[model samples]
Target: MTLHRFAFPTAIHFGAGARKGVADHLRQAGCRRPLIVTDRALAALPVLAEFRSHLDGLEVAVFDGVFGNPTASQVMAGAQAFKQHRADSLIGFGGGAALDVAKVVGVMAVHEGHVLEYVWDHPQVRPIVHPLPHFVALPTTAGTGSEVGRSSVVSEDDTHVKRIVFSPQLLARAVFADPELTLGLPPAVTAATGMDALTHNVESYLSPAYHPLCDGIALEGTRIAARSLRTAVAEPGDLAARGDMLMASMMGAIAFQKDLGAVHACAHALGAVCDLHHGLANALMIDTVLAWNFEAVPHKFDELAHVCGLAGGGQAFVPWLRQLKADIGISGGLAQRGVRREQLPRLVELALADICHQTNPRPCTAADFERFFEAAL
Candidate 1:
């Protein structure tokens, strides 16, 4: 095995009631005024009020206009809110969408251009502004691990393209993973996000990279998700299960720095065009993509099958996934989720452009993506 270096930049605090540490983290970071970016649903929750009360003397402004998949306009609105309040830091206090938008707000606020100007597709985009405002991410979901990641996903308004914003500076100054906050997440959200975590782990393990550490993390993360996600979803108040899922989620993000593959590529395209939930979309395509990529790395699946406690080798993994999805009430495929056959070609083109495509185990062409989409449908 080749030598590889793994870097984890963010300071993480994990457990029940970890949200209580947010104020102190802000104080330590020397932030007096911070912008709290979240969605309207979360903003209205009592947890948000409690968090605000804890902030007491610290000036905290709320921007709750973020939607399912954050848009460029939403980032602009968040940036405006940050600027208007003269926020010295950002508190991302919800799921992946909210955190992504908050990271974008931090990036665009200090930079001297429109959010679209820094989009990945823009050839002239400069490196993100350095030493951006202190970001403190508090994850209310048990997945997405946006709290620890250096990239943000923002959608383009005109073309509906979901663009990835990459910058090491976008990583949080600190992360608070409070399982108590995740207790109120709906069962569907819990199941979908958990599968998303599973996808991250699986893809990272399959990545043709030299990062043995990431491979180990990804394998163990998959085990945690397999053992705990169902229990977490079934018994929302189970602190142990929630904590394990939280760890698994963070591990999923960290490990995927090695790479993600075709499942994410396809899911990103679906999210761009159909407005489907990111995690659920990935869940729907997981089995199909796994089957497609099986030939490239069969033994990895065999190892995963053993780790997941399934019966056979590589083939056992797919059935295990199907059973898990069924138990979680995730029974539908892309067609059931409103993806039409006519959309395949366009989605394939978009999937091909996704950054995740670069790390796929087997080289995937437009035709390959179409076949995957059709098989998934």
Candidate 2:
């Protein structure tokens, strides 16, 4: 038997009003001053103001420099904001991009070098010797679940290649998963991010890594997303659907601690090369990659089909995913989404470089990646 370690350590406050407790939680932890790391767009919204109202008694500063995908420069700027305001804690207050930047702000603030040097692949990757600030997350969208994750995916400022900073210390001290915060998301964003949650569950379940705990979470997360995603997108005000999607998003994030597969590999490539939204990239590539991945893990596909309520079992799973994408407003292929044929070579190369596919049940080769991109296109 092989021995594998498992941990589920983030404290999550889930419900309609969970954001209301953030100030008290920080106070109890002796965090009087906190930096709210978020994007420029979210900063201009009323939601930010409303969330800030809950922290009325506490000293709060907002860092709204995060835009596009999280980047090295953004993390550096956020760290500067943290020092400038003398923040004792961090509140990640937007979508995945903002939350990813928030997770590493403290690393740059207290550590010795540029944020890229801490990436796991760096030749002299700096060790995370000191503790990060007291970080809490309040997600304004239901994707990536960066709030509960122990990793941050920040892109290089120049090349736009995504680099991951992984450490247990990056995990948020607590997560306020308030579905109300997601109720304002546009239909297109809801569709894309919901597909991202579904893809995480699907790909994690398909990964060959040995982690039954993650397998169980991934299946249930798949079920929840299958049932609730369309409703959430159609009726944005439906708190129940929004809440289920939120739970599914976090569950997918937790389950992926077992790691991911080719879908993520392709999606990360698209994010880096085409400047695509990570969630949308996942949405675009999931069915194509899963269709290619099916024969290698037929039993797993059958299990996924069962949970997703597809009567044709394994064979129906991919078709159902295709329909779901169309139903939720994510129609069309990669080409329709602005991916050019000339970019295919670079995408394949980047996909091959991404670490996510190492755990894929079907071992992916360069030729396989090229084929996957062509098929998706």
Candidate 3:
């Protein structure tokens, strides 16, 4: 078994109608006026309507400018909105992009400097110094697990490279994980996001870091996603399935702070290079990267197979993942998703530079990344 230190960072309020008490929770946290950070797409969806109804007339300002892969400019804009509204806190409400922007917004609100100056692996990066505005997250999607995480992935405007901004202070003060908010998700969103949760679990477990608690949570998260994702995708209205996937997503998020592996490196590159949906990109590249990594850590795959209910052991997990994605309608590899053959060099460069791959069970070289990308294609 692996060994490491662990801590539960986010206070969680879970169950049906959980979003109803957002105002009370915010008030208790000393937030009288919070800027609700979300995407333009979800500003007035039925889920947001229900959330507003739960607030029972407590007024809140909203910045709904975040759309798909949040950029540094969006975070800066959200911070400006937070200041303009005289908002004392932030509520990250919507999908991963919204939540990501919200987290960084809270950082930018209190700290002086450009958001990129605090990016995780950047040279010339500055340290966070101020206490952030209180933040509460109510995730509308079960994927990305950004609600419980301490990091946000933001794309750079000029290069479009995805940079992870990490700080323990970015963790939400509380999370209202209501599965009811997820019921309205379309089938494609549901499938892709669920698979993202699965990738987190599998990659975290396979990472060469020693974190037994994370390993345990990773296995259970994998189990939850395997059993619940298909049901949630097919029946969209199944609260039980939705809730399980939600829990699994949260678990994956917490577990992966021990860090991820080649899959995420590749996924991050795909997002940067192609502007593809993060989860869908993970769904496409997961099998290819993990297969490349299988020879180095076969035992982890064997354990993964056992947890996911596959008949075969280590060798079976990759095929099972590939089929699982196919069965749920996540189509094709990198090329099918619009990555050109000529772009392989850039993708490989991005993937190799990504710090996420440092803990990969197998050291990924440029040649290996080319083969993996080729295999994915």
**Compared with the true structure, what per-residue lDDT tens digits does model 3 show for residues 168-286?**
98999999999999999999999999988988988899987888889899999999999999899999999999999999999999899879998899889888998988889889889
Clashing pairs in 1: none
lDDT of 2 at 282: 95
For model 1, give the 10-residue run with minimal summed lDDT: 1-10
Question: What TM-score do all the candidates reach, one by one?
Answer: 0.97, 0.99, 0.97
Q: Cα RMSD to native, each candidate?
A: 1.4, 0.7, 1.6
- The alpha-carbon lDDT assigned to residue 64 of candidate 1 equals 100
lDDT of model 2, residue 253: 96
lDDT of each: 0.89, 0.94, 0.89
Model 2 Cα shift for residue 171 (angstroms): 0.7
Question: What lDDT does candidate 1 reach at residue 371?
Answer: 86
Better of 1 and 2 by lDDT: 2
lDDT of 2 by residue, 103-218 (tens): 99989878888999999999999999988899999998887988889999999999999999999999999999999999999999999999888888888898898999999999
After superposition, candidate 2 runs with Cα above 4 Å error:
none
